[model samples]
Target: MKKVIIVGAVGGGATAASQLRYYDKEMEITVYDRDTTMSYAACGTPYVIGGVIEEESSIIMATPEQFQDKRNIDVLLEHEIIEIRRSQKQVLVRNLATGKEFTDSYDALILSPGGSAIMPEIDGMDGHVFSLRSYADMQAIQSFIAREKPSHCVVSGAGFIGLEMAENLSHLGLEVAIVHKSASILSILDEDLSKILQKELLSHGIDVYTDAVIDKINGNTLHLSNGKKLESDLVIMSIGLKPNTSLAEQAGLSIGVTGGIQTNDFMQTDDPFIYAIGDATENDDFITGDPKRVPLAVPAHRQAFIAARHITGNPIAKKGLLGTSILKVFDLDAAMTGLTETQIKEKGLLAKTVVHIGNSNAGYYPDHSKLTLKVHYNPETRQLLGAQCIGGKGVDKRIDVLATAIYGGLTIDDLQALELCYAPPFSSPKDPVNMIGYKAIE
Candidate 1:
């Protein structure tokens, strides 16, 4: 029987192991993870910290016992793969609990090491600083919150994770303040839309500081580059994430400019026997065709499918990522897919943008909240380059439709012809998507 060894047992790795089993029932599959917990929903960590998710165990999707009994796969938690010997098709595994090392040989190997949260270098950051990248990190933050009962929190960075953490922390009745280095929060959206979100954050009693950086953390007080001092009982850093590619680099795999393992369309590394997936691997962008790292769960899951299929004698080329993402800020939903208008201008692409302000449904409908839709397209080719939507409702649906359109290679004009569901309670006769397409023509 063919033996397979997978490193990491989270989103991509666990999914790949199950997929591999589905394709080849008789294959020997063993997954190793350094963490005691495996296959937990990392995205919901913030909710748990905020007490929204009452129990941390609720986020865990699968356990080792479950994988072994149901899937007939060996899942060794707290076993870390220290080194990969490509010549012998073996890996040096260390029992983290016992400090013993062993060698395991594999016919095929998959790496899904994921990423690490970036902790910026700031003076006096040794006290009450936290980052949410792992289950342990979430538990630590919750423990601190429960024990200390911190009254105020200073969240550094204003991206998706940052905003989510802020909202959750605020939900716990803690005074929340967000300080972002960029000109606007949620850089995925343009400044105008981001400004609206900034207002939302402010309206919810969350202080918003733009173009500011944390220079030092002295005790529970944070000093900013803008000459402002914030009294934070604890600080959460959601600045960014760096791909965990040290193992791949040590194995002599080709690393891309994005600092992720470079893989072919088959998700195979430079060594055909070794496959890489998840945030640790960089793939081509959907529109630009340039290498990009998408550290989102959906992309990781999709890559897991592609990698497993290729290993099981079925090959499928990976369609590039659109970087589609969405996040909820207090009461508003912000979503975007494909390239942004700023990115198009930076690429010197000839693009035109259409902005439409309309209602989630018909204006006559009760509680019809306002929605803003912005789309970017090539004037000559009419190809939809990107889209952004922010509203109280229907933002997710429209973004999914646009993302699907971009995936299907649909042009801006095609959106006008889209037969979207229309009702007074759901959408208007000319949906916001259709209205944007119609406005693009004018």
Candidate 2:
């Protein structure tokens, strides 16, 4: 019987443990998490905060007891793995609740400590400020909102989390101001597309400040570098995430340029008997083949399968990542898959991009709506590289098709050739996706 131990039982770790148990029923498995709530969807935290999801417990997919009973996998909640002894093949773990320490030996180990919220040092920033990373963080933010009933919120950082927090806080009827040091937000979208999204945000009364800086925070007052001050009742930092790789670094594992654990297509680290997954590991870019960190839940869950299959002796290679993602803001929807024009330019890759606008449904239909679609392709080979879509409806479905097309090694010609179903209520005769493809060919 093989003994396996997994750390950080959230998206990646929990999924890996479940996969291993499914493949080898007799395998001895133990999963440890520093937090009590394990196997819950972290991505759904924003909706819960916004009252879009009413029940907090509904997000939890499985409990420790449930996993232990059904999967026969031992789950230790509120247990922290402090150290890994590579030579001894054992981990020194401390019970977070009791401060008691113990050792667990393993024939194989999976590392998935995930990422940490990067909170920069600003004057007077303390417990009063917040960043949502875990279930606890979400609960704290909710508690603060309920207790104080704050009317004004200053959310620093205009990235994914920042935007989501901004929208959710605004949905709660609070005036939200989004601040970013950059000239524009959403680095995933081109400047023109991002400008349109910015206007949509302005229509919702959400304040956006680009090319901005936070000078200091004194009590409830936030002073800006441009000599502006806001009476802020709440502050949320959504700057970015740093990969949790200190354990791997201490264990002498190799790190990548992206500051994540370096692993092969099999997810095997430099140490053959060990593996890493989730936000803690860097991924190979599908289009540019660059070392990239895609801190999304879907890729983490997929990596679990790849690691588990290889551990069970299948030795399957994983497909490189496209960093496919989507988000909702008020009445609008935005999604992106594959490389962006900005990234392609940075990599010195020649890409032909086409931006097209079309109605999602037949123009004459009552429910028809316009969507902006951008597709990127190799100028020479005409291979499909990436795509972005912004619209009220059908954005999600369109992004998924483009992601699949990229994965299938499809080209611009292939995209135009894709035979898609159409109805007066749902799609136009020339679907928005096909429109982009046809534009790419031109």
TM-score against native, each model? 0.99, 0.98
Model 2 per-residue lDDT tens digits across residues 194-241? 887888889999988888877799999998877788778899988889
Per-candidate local distance difference test: 0.94, 0.90
**Who wins the TM-score comparison?**
1
Query: What RMSD does model 2 have?
Result: 1.0
Q: List, residue by residue over 1-442, the lDDT tens digit for candidate 1.
A: 8998999999999999999999999999999999999999999998888888888799999999999999999999999999999999999999999999999999999999999999998889874899999999998998899899999999999998899999999999999999999999988898899999999999999999999999988888899999999999989999999999999999999999999999999899999999999988989999989999999999999999999999999999999999999999988999999998788888898899999998999889897889999999998999999999999999999999999999999999988899999989999999999998898885
Off by over 4 Å in 2: none
The 10 consecutive residues of candidate 1 with the worst lDDT sum are 120-129
Instruction: Score residue 292 of candidate 1 by CA lDDT.
Output: 92
The regions of model 1 sitting more than 4 angstroms off are none
